[model samples]
Target: MDWMRDWVQAVRECEGGALGTVLCLALLFVWYCYRVGCEHASYTPESRSSPPELSSAKLRPTLGGVRTGGGASEEELNGFAYCQSPECFRCSRPGNGFNQRLYHNLQDYAKRYTWAGMGRVHKGVREQDRYRLCNRPSIQKAEVFFLPDLPSAPFFSRDAQKHDVELLERSFPALLAEFESVYRTPPPLAPGWKANSTPRGHWWTFYLVNQGTTLALNARRCPRTWRVLGQLRTFISNNVFGNACFSVISPGATITEHYGPTNVRLRCHLARLFTLDAASRGERRLRPTAGPERLH
Candidate 1:
């Protein structure tokens, strides 16, 4: 070993420049080999089989009150609140005086509106063997309803028709334009709430306020966009006795199954924003399912 060392030293001294360069190159090769080996080990099938366990410690409560993370506590988050939650209901009550007018308007309009169209019918048997169904829930599910198409249903009157058109043209155009601007793209203004669902193409919604005003627009309605405006006018003229809103759900998105509280009021969905997936549609998914539907 001593002799070998002596010989190596002599070679280094005699070929110092070449030896140094070779040494550097050899070190670089070893480093490259080590990096390749590490990469292979990291990407091995077994290593990739299970993703790194997400750290529950890093999870946080979102504003919507949903807890996320592998080990997040099942307990509901404090700050996060569902729109349908009792607390939210209290918060959402129209402010005194300000909301009174709004409420009165909606109530009056609703009284006159006789919902029509092919309203949905819910019929099913629960595990208890009891069967039940109604069109009211579908109306509520969509967060809107149509007036019955009858002469007495408030829609057939020429006066009501004129009133409805005036409301749509004056009050709703700006509101609809605002809605369109906000939802033209993904990731709506509200966090964790998409305006649309991935499976359902889009949602069409209408809003009726007190003071004889009506608003209607489709986030994704095509061609005669004005037609939707006209429909709102017609519906309101016939049914706008009480303050109310209307909605339409196009085919494709199954609003999933859900329930609501109270039977005195109904909800409806006005289909708009049509797309392949309802989940990816837009904002407003976070909005409560009208009045009666309860959120689980």
Candidate 2:
């Protein structure tokens, strides 16, 4: 309600003849309202009975667009926390031509800006990369580098451990059971890794968390594994790298040596049964005799 009040007040303060800004703002408002309405409409009383938690989970954006809920503390969650800085709302920078053109109502004004108008007004200014991994001097031979502050070790086991990697390893039986239950029936193993051009065999991924947001239907199917993942805070929850999935690789699959989009995130594998051979040239060859394997 407070946000709504501020948004309306900000609109009122805008001077006349700012037709471009007003039209853009109005279209954005309509889009927001439409999305809200459609979301609510999808959740009927009868539909709420099945997959209740997943269907009814309320997702509100936190600082830097990170979403948090389900009893996880801010510290436990990774990536950038929710932001409420004045810069998040303000657009009227002195001597900025784009700000002056876009935010004529906010230019040189002392009043606080609204969140709804924030995106529109701040369009011209390029947001600084919150985490740059490759630029660090210490980082070398890394494929993707964003948020290089995270642990970049080649491997960790026995002594060196950040979060509870063992917990996931121990819960393999329960997690695998849940995973099999989802893809076992009609839509068994959805084809994945369609974008990768180099893989010789096949790679299929059933994701629980895609870009830090939990998939409702998938989470509903794998409640046990999801709960297990909740115990560990190391999962990359950033926009791109944030994902946890069950990977099924065909036998003799040769996933060519390739760097992920970014290296700030760590890749952990919890194989039910698989033999991986690192080639001399850095290629990864997977030889799996089992049914399916889980990877995070």
Candidate 3:
């Protein structure tokens, strides 16, 4: 207290000694006050965040086909038309509380369970000879399908374990039953999709979900399959891209070698009714083809 009083007395004496000194002190005081006010305003809930109801209003779409609030429409903020509903898995609105948490959690999960989409080079190989080890046979007639700048692997045994494909494998009987009950007749075939290596046969596809979207009618028809699909966290469930389907390649049909559109996702194939002869391994052929493949 004595020190405080002495300091105050000294400051008082200094205030009377020079006008320039007083002006400097006054300017410092004003700056300090301004900073304090800003800090206080930043900490207040009213300044930091709006009421939930009011903030939610901004997320809602208006009559003009643009999002409201947040100082600008979504189109203006992103500089293009971007309309992902809050419910979508890929709706990455980090400003919103739920989406922010979800986005971070997904990122963490992906980091732990997935490859970061990098095409790995063989260790200890010289940079100049990198292509020598990875290249295909020169005699192959068809052009090799290549998706640029993505992790390439012949198999994904690790991804199968990460996605818990064994869980789906255990429930295969239920999935098969659902498939049987729903699709009594052969599902339609893809024409422009991929022709049979020979012109005589057809390849049919029965899809419960396609392009990260659950077909409502198909989902309703096969509840068990739908329920099982939802349990896998790493399954490509985004509305923008991904697929879950049953492909039936008929006897005497040969599907020509093809590549998937992207290399980021592991294309998993579950043999619902394949024999385990000496040539075949166990039922789980957790093959990683060149695309977004998931457990179905």
lDDT by candidate, in order shown: 0.36, 0.49, 0.49
Q: Provide the TM-score for each candidate, comma-separated.
A: 0.23, 0.42, 0.41
- Using TM-score as the measure, name the better of candidate 1 and candidate 2: 2
Q: Deviation in angstroms for 157 in model 1?
A: 6.3
Off by over 4 Å in 3: 1-151, 158-160, 188-200, 274-296
Q: Candidate 1: where are CA atoms >4 Å away? A: 1-84, 87-161, 169-176, 187-251, 256-296
lDDT of 3 by residue, 23-76 (tens): 899999999999777644434445334422222333444556454343344433
**lDDT by residue (tens digit), candidate 1, 133-244:** 1221232221112222212221123343455444444544454455555444443342222232322244333333321343333323322343444555333333323334
- In terms of TM-score, the best-performing candidate is 2
Q: Candidate 3 versus the native: TM-score?
A: 0.41
Clashes of each: 75, 4, 1
| Candidate 1 RMSD computed on C-alpha atoms after optimal superposition onto the true structure | 26.7
Q: Give candidate 3's whole-model lDDT.
A: 0.49
